[model samples]
Target: MGAGLPADDRARAIIDLVRGQGYQTIEALAAQFGKTTQTIRRDVNLLCDRGLLRRKHGGVELPPEDENLAYPARQVLNIEAKRRIAELVARNVPDNATLFFGIGTTPEQCALALSDHPGLRVMTNNLNVAMALTRNPSCEITIAGGRLRNLDRDVVAAEARDFFSRFSVDIGIYGVGAVAEDGTLLDFGLDEVEMRRSLAQHCRQRFLVLDHSKFGRDATVRGGHITEATAVFTDRPVPPAIAGQLKEAGIRLVVWSDDATHTASSNGRG
Candidate 1:
């Protein structure tokens, strides 16, 4: 429905994702909205000039202390950083692995990065993930059946838990709404969090991917702690206290900065 959705609705969706995720890149926006890069750029320019968004290196982000942007807007945010995280996630998740892509723009980016890998099975509650992974001919995709959340195109309900109960996944990847001050892994909805916990419990490994914007942001649902993730991939240095907590909890932090990779090049946390 997103691909065939009207221009105005598409733009609004972009704004929702951007606001929620904090960033969106021009190219990613174009792909997600099924528009040309030129068209998306025009929209971004208007939004920026109106003081709604600020330009990033290759994307647009919520300006000032904004809490959330459109989903399409977030698809474009921190494009390079998300791509780097996606690449590493794809590389680490072996071919033929069974994966679960939970809600968030970054998980959709991970689906895009996995377009080439063959012999994979993916289950997701996010419509964006299903659309992105449709390019991979060899990958079998399963979508959870549940009530649709119009703004984000995610499926969540009692049936969603049943959907996860049917599969044993090899890798589970998710995007966070924010990292709460008390070291809680936060998100927006209680249903979404419960669905995520269910999906995560079925996987052998779970990784959390988010850009720097999530830190210090406010979100209502306490999903869990960073320790729930086997590894956390971010685009910048984490707050020292958070990093220490991650290290202490035995969660690996992988930062994808422009200058270098704060990776688990060895088994150690960064």
Candidate 2:
């Protein structure tokens, strides 16, 4: 099924397959996908370095449960794809709009994309997002009060959820730790899930911003489903099942990759 895909796309497919089966040997993957072991090795190596997979003896598997890739590494993984997604998401926000920016490097990129917009009021738990929005002198930033998570450089705790619940915003933008094949959103901790749900509940329009790698990824805590979002911005096409769910829910779906030519959107509800 993955044989005819582009190298990058095939890599993504390999991940989905591995995620489904827990682990997959390079030879098995190569045979299943009709690719040579050498090609599969290259794919596995790239995905492993990106923290999307971990190399086993003769196979690859998902990263350790509940623990995500280091924040710094995540910041650079698929960076160009992130920028493209961020830019497209920012374009949809109007000046002076109030927003809830959730934690994650992707949301940080969104903050950077929104820097050029004037008069944005952003409430976030992400220190990085707050710092990035500082570039926009007109943006009013309100940060949550909680013990900062030094590694992720964000706050995702009960206090953070309370802080977000205090204000209703025009738009809520957030990223998830993973997207289960069944369309459920997953995060590393219960606090993170609570905080994100609070962000979405208070917003008039919730934008779920994620990248292709998020699909079929693994995370411990289950949160709200992706269909809850008013709109989703991603760097690649979603799995067919997910795309159908989004369409059925009347949620807008936008696929804007680094390759501008692949950008597309289907209008739905706010």
Candidate 3:
């Protein structure tokens, strides 16, 4: 086989193929792309090193759904898409509303977008979020006391759950590690899951924010169901099956594209 494009372009296409179909082989990619076996191996190794994929017995495959990228790695992925979803969610947050925030990159993005929202009280398990929204002095911030996980900069466990119990927030915003194939919302830590559930109970409306990358991704702890959230904001269209499930559950689905929010309901899964 002969090289058809630059190494980076071929590498990207290799990842896309694996992401869509589960896995791909160095031999197969070499044949399809007209590249040598050694060249394909190099591409797979680079992606694996970056935590984008993993080496299976004979082929490279997407990482396990529960296998999270490094916190820093996660923050840089889908950056513009996250900003778009953040804008969509933040636009609906009024100035005087009290809110709850959990941990994860997408929620962090949402907090940043709410910097100018005034007259709000925010109770959060994420210290970074507290600091981000503090840019608006008009908004009071309260952070839960707990042992902080330095990797993700989130406070979790008994104290965090107890602290969230003290307030009835107008909105509870959360990010999932992944949305399961069955439409179940999932995260990684058990304590974080409990804390999120507690926060949800203390809020009047719940908003789940995540990008489309989480679709079909895996995670271990169960946070809640799609029906549990009042609405979900994302950067890509929901697939037909998931859209139907959400619609049947009567949860509003909003997808952002070209700086516009296109809404879909249970009846309009097209």
Q: Which residue pairs in model 2 clash with each other?
A: none
Any idea what lDDT model 2 has? 0.90
Name the candidate that leads on lDDT. Answer: 2
TM-score of each: 0.74, 0.77, 0.78
lDDT of 1 by residue, 154-210 (tens): 898766777787899888999888887667877777787888888888888888888
Give the higher-lDDT candidate: 1 or 2.
2
How many backbone clashes are present in model 3? Answer: 2
Q: In candidate 1, how many clashes are counted?
A: 23
| TM-score, prediction 1 | 0.74
Count clashing residue pairs per candidate.
Answer: 23, 0, 2
Rate residue 224 of model 2 by lDDT. Answer: 95
Off by over 4 Å in 3: 1-62, 259-270
- Model 1 local distance difference test score: 0.81
Q: Which stretches of candidate 1 lie over 4 Å from their true place?
A: 1-67, 257-270
lDDT: worst 10-residue window of model 3: 261-270
lDDT of each: 0.81, 0.90, 0.82
Local error of candidate 1 at residue 22 (angstroms): 16
